[model samples]
Target: MDCLFEILCWNVRGLNDPAKRDAVRVFVASLRVSIICLQETRLNVIDDFLVMQCLGPSFDGYVYLPAIETRGGILLAWNKSLVNIERVSFDSHTVTGEVVPRDNNRWWLTTVYGPQTHEEKIDFLWELAERRSLCPGLWCLLGDFNMILYAEEKNNDRLDRFIMSRFRQFVLEHEVKDLYLQGRRFTWSNEREVPTLSRIDRAMVSVDWDLMHPDAILQALSSSVSDHAPIHHSLSAAFRPKRRFKFESFWLNLEGFDEALREAWVCDPGIVDPFRRLDALFRNAAEYFQAWGERKLGNIKLKIAMANTLILRFDVAQESRRLSQAEAWLRKVLKLVVLGLASLQRTIAR
Candidate 1:
């Protein structure tokens, strides 16, 4: 039989969207994996996956992605049956997380959020390479590394020498290898006319993990909602696919809109169109209003889909420590240390 205890790393975006993150979850759920590292939960204090969060009784959840940032960090969930609980740490850069199993287990599971830029991302990868030297033993690093290692990863951009160098360094230094490529090399892209495909998001393992799970395989699900597809790969002796979203037709199902937003998006006609960024606002608002009206969305989640029109206003991290109520609530809700785990429990989109 195929090996079990498989792990998945995905950019779910938000668990609330049925067509988006939820679709990806369905694909992962089919895998029957053990641990899942989720990124870009985009959750707020009020957001909840509800029934979706209760996947496994023995699993422990960790939510390092602050809801305030809504995009920069991550959420991790692991089955207790697979590994004993121990310690977990989120990096100061909001780009890496380390899970050290209890009782001196010779393994480290880290989900990395690589830097976004050409330079920053390489720096982050080197940081990973450096970490490998500091901590010996089996290491499994996965998630949206955000750097395409090859030209085949993107359709138009030639292989970036600098980017390639950094990735190679990490792999060479850590003795890491990619899980078998499942399908198309591209794991992420903006589904547009040209359709950019890049394999920036991936899972990697060191010699130790490779030996333990020689049968490991990395498969990318179709882009359903988010820009990144869900990745399912086996590790050790277990395999569990991420949960798929069963979208119910309801306005509450559509997230973002709080009790019917009546305010129309005001397009400042004064803005010029030459620069794509500045003119994007008006175009999106018009698009949102049109989509909203066409759908006649009654489901809350769908209604919130209109808010997706607001998604382009991307900021790396919201850094909401300034929000007193939000911070207090986090302290009460997330017990990463004593409990040894907590989870944002976001659903899949792409």
Candidate 2:
């Protein structure tokens, strides 16, 4: 049951607007992300409808901490088919849960949204240490920490050595490895004339957790509608079983398919017995149709991979700078293209 395990973490700022919610849905749908962690949702109440609006229909399991007034909310959602989570708990700034991925291994996932002020931030750090004590075994602590571990992480004059030391001490105590963002420097921006950027958002995993997903990749994606870029963490690729060939109904609907099939069926294997001759003819037709379909339809799986690669290129570009109108349009179009390709792939597999 080894399946794809990918998580998307973002400080979406807010999802009150329908557009932002729709944008989230598009991202989830396009990327086929299994787990989602959203910070600063700024929504006082969250329902199934809102979850569907933001994460799409596939993400059926969720837990959320409502905001105080119009600030500081967290939402964690996962696809039920891929992962089963239990022992869920939440406070003002964190959501902790025991996740069982399709591989049937158990691990803790703590999604954090650290405090802004100095005094409250200390308390938040202590709470995180406490959370670690409660969550044993392989653990993944991730999301917006709201604090930088190093001076280079932020492009600003403000540097809090005390807070940085405390965060580092916590990581050292737990022995969690920071799966630092690759290819991009910052995960958040103030979006000003002289923009303020920081790498406060990240994923940290215990040694055991890292062993479980040795090939995991972490990267910051372009933020289209938020101040924070979405960070993607993907485990090893999904295990795909060998595909069994099946006749496609759509093949019969093609223009010259009938003629091709007739030509294929007309081929004789030169057998004497009637039953054996019929069997040979059927096998010949199946082989010919399989080759013909390959030539005419092309490979849906390859197209899906190419589309995903193009989208990732756009996402990485968006992380550093805003994409052009044409590029944005193309990215959006590629999302739909991937979705259709995935559907066709599923149909062929069936």
Candidate 3:
């Protein structure tokens, strides 16, 4: 299938805060991925409004395994315009669905949020094996597995060898090829002086699935808030189309709007005739408005990116030492800025 299909798997830690939701939505919009698999939502209920907070309006279809009293949760949302879900089912740890992308055949996608305890981890693997038997066709799995296949996957060089062996054996027996992460070595981190980093999140596909989507690539994306880095899996490397420019009505209410337009109109267009001069004046005013809008309003996307960068900087510093009161407050303010800008972008798009 040459049709493009992309999935974003993230362990958001929690989605209860509006700022966190806005950050997720902004990142999701930038990537333009068709499907989203979020783990550890920690929300007892997943509603349309809550889902909108993360995926926006386009991704209207979803199936979630709710959190157990503020614990684990999994949410799988897809854009209906890009992919049609034939069937969807969920359990305690996963949300499985049969997805059919435009001009492509159907395949099974399972978004997992594995357990932490060793006993629970064993059961999680067993459940996956059972699910694999049921979905014997083209299958692809992605999420925070909460376990690594090798010691090198962790920074501390420490792991339960027995558990690692079992996980590796499962992958081999099931023929689930663990797709190589293209951008980063580790996906999770514990922010501390002596930090622990591990590659717990992954994207794995069955042999037949790989044969169908040979061009598929997995990338570890940077996260602003979450401890786990989101992984993006795509079958094609297509660039997203640029958004259409529109004159925002809110711009007309700005303090210097009239003064700016008058200044542009007064500019000489090097024209002699009165009629031609009038046309030139209008052209100049249009150009002025576009430039003025950009300056006054600023590019929301760029502002959001800057805010994320600042937040990440603060987070990285916190790994070694606690931020002072001023820095902590500034970090919180930056998050709010991101949330507000994201909401503004949505309004402009609408």
Candidate 4:
């Protein structure tokens, strides 16, 4: 189990409007957010009243980098009771800090608003990579990155290979991974006559951070007020009961499963009232199945990730030239593998 806390990140576009600020306050309260990161606030300065109106009464402390005229700004706020934050560094594009939670566990968090232009975007990536070297422990970078990881993340436009490559390189260099997202696939929209959607807003965490908060999830909420949707990061509560035993579909494909089940079912001692005996037998079988599932399906996530990577590679290759016969067949096989794994996961959930 993990200690549950929710962090909400949004571009917000601007918070100067009273209605927009009220909407933000209502939204954050509704979500029960403990921490908030707002970008592109478009405010030259933040006062106590503005903070109170935007973040509400729950948040006790906040830090802001004021916007340069009307262009860029970043603000980070956290619940004083839940998180004790110490500012680490700040600039127009990012604010880095050390966050100590109520449990006394600490991590480094960087909230960013990447530059819009091509040259500036490249500089921002390099700056981020440099900053990553400062603190190596559980780290998370979250906010509007202003770029997408893959072509599929954008719709109604051709992918920008150069920008995508730079973003990919930054991830690889930093050894950070995108947390699996829930709800909407795209987090930002162009708000045009024909709207263009892209998942530019996201949360990326180090491998160490994932290990620390294994059950954390990122959700893309509806873009009700701003062009960019707010992203919520939720960590599970620390106290959780032992998981109930559930059958795994993949176990049926493994050898000796039936034999194992039979052995558990029949190896009952003589304390038998018929109903109690049956109950004991099933309990034993469930224990055996649980152990078996752990051994066999433990690496399923990694396997699925590998399959997705291969599929992505094939799709990218297909854009420029035809795939070879072997490549085409492998792509089909990988897709099936991914689908099968997903189906097995759904079965396990039931």
Give each model's whole-structure lDDT. 0.60, 0.88, 0.88, 0.86
- Candidate with top TM-score is 2
What candidate 1 gets wrong by more than 4 Å, as runs, is: 1-3, 15-29, 44-58, 92-106, 236-350
**320: Cα error in model 2, Å:** 59
Residue pairs in steric clash, candidate 2? none
**How would you encode candidate 3's per-residue C-alpha lDDT over 155-263 as one tens digit per residue?**
9857888889999999999999999999799999997778899999999999999988878899998966899999989887656586444567877788898898678
Q: Itemize residue pairs with steric clashes in candidate 3.
A: none
Model 4 clash number: 2
Which lDDT value does model 2 have at 332?
100
Please state the error at residue 276 of candidate 3 in Å: 22
TM-score of each: 0.57, 0.69, 0.67, 0.68
How many pairs of residues collide in model 3?
Answer: 0
Report the lDDT tens digits of candidate 1 across residue range 1-350. Answer: 32355677778667555455446555655667666777766554322353144233434544455544555646677665555434565563233334434333447777766666776775676677666666677777778877777777788865677878778766776678876677777888877888877887888887876776576677787666678887776644344575433432333456554333344344566666647544666555556655564465234354344433333222112352243565445443433321321111113221
Query: What TM value does model 3 have?
Result: 0.67
Per-residue error (Å), model 1, residue 9? 1.2
Q: Quick one: ranking by TM-score, best first?
A: 2, 4, 3, 1
> RMSD in Å for candidate 2, one decimal?
17.9
Ten-residue stretch with the least lDDT total in model 3: 237-246
